[model samples]
Target chain A: MRLSELSKRSGVSTATIKYYLREGLLPPGERITATQADYDEEHLRRLRLVRALVQVGRVPVATAREVLAAVEDESSDQLSRLGTAVGALPHGPTTTGDDAATERAGRTAEEVQRRLGWRIVPGNPAHRMLISSLATLIRLGYPCEVDHLLPYGRAAAGIAEHELALIGEFEAPTTQLEAAVALTVLYEPVLLALRRLAQAEEAGRRFGANRGAGADPAADAEGEG
Target chain B: MRLSELSKRSGVSTATIKYYLREGLLPPGERITATQADYDEEHLRRLRLVRALVQVGRVPVATAREVLAAVEDESSDQLSRLGTAVGALPHGPTTTGDDAATERAGRTAEEVQRRLGWRIVPGNPAHRMLISSLATLIRLGYPCEVDHLLPYGRAAAGIAEHELALIGEFEAPTTQLEAAVALTVLYEPVLLALRRLAQAEEAGRRFGANRGAGADPAADAEGEG
Candidate 1:
């Protein structure tokens, strides 16, 4: 198929497709003529994955590039690398750059990897992006550690896995490809929305009162003194 | 006691105190001399409040001004207006105009007030900042609702109230004050860290499996056909 056909099918613009190609995000199609190119099913699959990472995941182009590289790497240790990358992100009290922070982040990542025992490629771009984001937050004065956040991350991961396992329960997609589509289009929004609701509820509880009025004057005096 | 003394007592910088005074974030202390000023406990209390709204709550300067105004208002409707301002934040779907965004934010503030039935004053810069952050996220394509988030906000507030209720929770000037410090310094980081963990877990579950496996031929066929 031509660029137009791919654009129409993928619902992504022609300009975007070109950009992806230029950025080495999407592989070049077979040259059919001086001005034409032929794209195959693989191109479409790549396109969808790109959309999932860039759009739904909200990853930046540079980071997305790294992730794509990891995905395509054929080394035997790729999976292990991927796992390390995912684990490296800042979660709780993990600091960035400083020796202590690095050690803490490394130890936590190793621990999580040991628990899961999954072969994942280290240096995954998503992991880097997440870690970078946490680092940025810390620089802006929010102190937290990755280990403290690990439990919640693990729980959320469990939920996501559960949701994926149940995808077969749906009748709309008989094949894995259709299932992937349904999962990407419908489930992504639903999961994100649900998470937002959860956070909002948590925020409310932290700032509001169920314990009754402001501080007593005597108590205030003691505290300030 | 001059401005420098007030700064030392409050643990806020002299420059910051000056900024606060100029911005009308703080009421004037007694001017005993042309160059010397006398600030009492009231000034200290207000400074602490200002810090809470600015640093911990991330309230913008202008909005903080408005909230402070509402806080100082003595009218019967002061509470209601305060509640409106505190709860009001730009939430819901995207809006193009600043006025529209402000109006939408006000509705969210009102919702928070209605739910908690607190006589929260308007013009709180912290409240405005929170609302603006939510709006920015929405604009960035994060699908979240103010109404949905209200529960989370309330939960945080509840926690704050409980912390305040703990007598002898702190050994010092006031347990409420101590609680406020702990809540601001510790709780915010913990909550933010947890949220980040949750998101990471979600991403992991979605992308962890079938990773490194080339597009499943069977799945690809289904998605395209």
Candidate 2:
């Protein structure tokens, strides 16, 4: 197949595919002539991954390039490759200012990780993400205690386990990496939407027609009385 | 209290507070004189919510303003207020192109909602979010079936129940709304980070030193056989 067919099959525009080639996101196809190059199934697969990263994941081309390099770095073990790829993806907001809040956030993140008995890579952006959000929650008067978050961590771990099982169905490391990256980015909204829908449903179940009976007895007893 | 006290109590800058007042995201304090006005604890609470929306949630001030209006509209029942506020928040990517893919994504989202028995509001942005993300996954060759997502939905519902329980602990509707909005925004990064950390941990557990024994027995059997 040529670039045209690759573009057609991948449903990516020829020009955008060329741009990917120029950006080294898609490795150059085998040169067949002065004006033509032949692409293969690998190119199509890589193109789809690149499109998913750059377009669907909304990662910058630079970040996508870096993630791809991590994916293709065959020297690294599969576990390390998956970690590197996920770590390279853009993180949520970085924490800033208020050293005390930052410190509190760090301690809480450590506590959750510790409670979960998981060893996270040093300086994974998720650490910063957890810190940033937790810090905000603390500042805003919400209970930022680890007790509130541990259940969430456990649930997240279960979901992640399920997702990783899906990724492991792929035989090749590159395919696994692509699946990991795409699913990680894509399933995010699915998870979030489900959470929101569930919130609405749960809110309805608890508070819909019975405002007087809204609060759980335990929670009601613990309210600001 | 005065503007400075409100600023100090909320940990928001006076300039930002003034900006919020100007933007009407925060109501103006009662005018005591030309250059002096009295503020109250309600002002402080509103300021905190505004800060959470604009800074932590990263919603545009305009969107925050709309959300705040929904929160303050006491004429609406608490459930409607919560629904309105969550719905007003900016959603994930709006899906584009490939009408067939869009239709498939919509059907899939509807199926998941139906399976979960969630009656999602007819145009909730989460619906679009699910569609956008599911469409992307389908385009990328992943199994976008509802079965693959029902577990996620169930898990999400559980988390949402826990969260709403926390919100329910608040006695006042306004306070509950503030907690709901802030928790919804702030806990997002926390949830995402947990999932990523969990993915890393689960990956290590399953694949650390045993490549041949990587997949779960069930998933292994289902691999591209």
What's the lDDT for all of these models?
Answer: 0.48, 0.82
lDDT tens readout by residue for model 1, A1-225: 999999877767999999999998799999999989999876876776667566644656876676565545556242343433333322323335754434454454444433433323345433433344344333332333444444434544454444344434434322322233223332333333223332333333333334325733233213210
Candidate 2 segments exceeding 4 Å error: A96-98, A210-225, B96-98, B210-225
The superposed Cα distance between candidate 2 and the true structure at residue B62, in angstroms, equals 1.8
Tens digit of lDDT per residue, candidate 1, span B1-225? 678887866667999999999999888888898877888876776676677567655677886677566555546242243334443322222222474445565566545544544433344434444455444433322223545444444444444343333412434433233233323433343333333333334344444456635543233213211
TM-score: model 2 vs. ground truth: 0.91
The per-model DockQ list reads 0.08, 0.40
Clash pairs, candidate 2, are none
lDDT of 2 by residue, B1-225 (tens): 988888777788889888888999888889999999899988887777878778877899889988998898999988889889988887878755666787888888887877777774657777777888888877766779888998899889789989988998988988998889878887888899889888887888776867635554333223221
Error of 1 at A47 (Å): 4.3
| Candidate 1 TM-score for chain A | 0.52
- Candidate 1 has a DockQ of 0.08
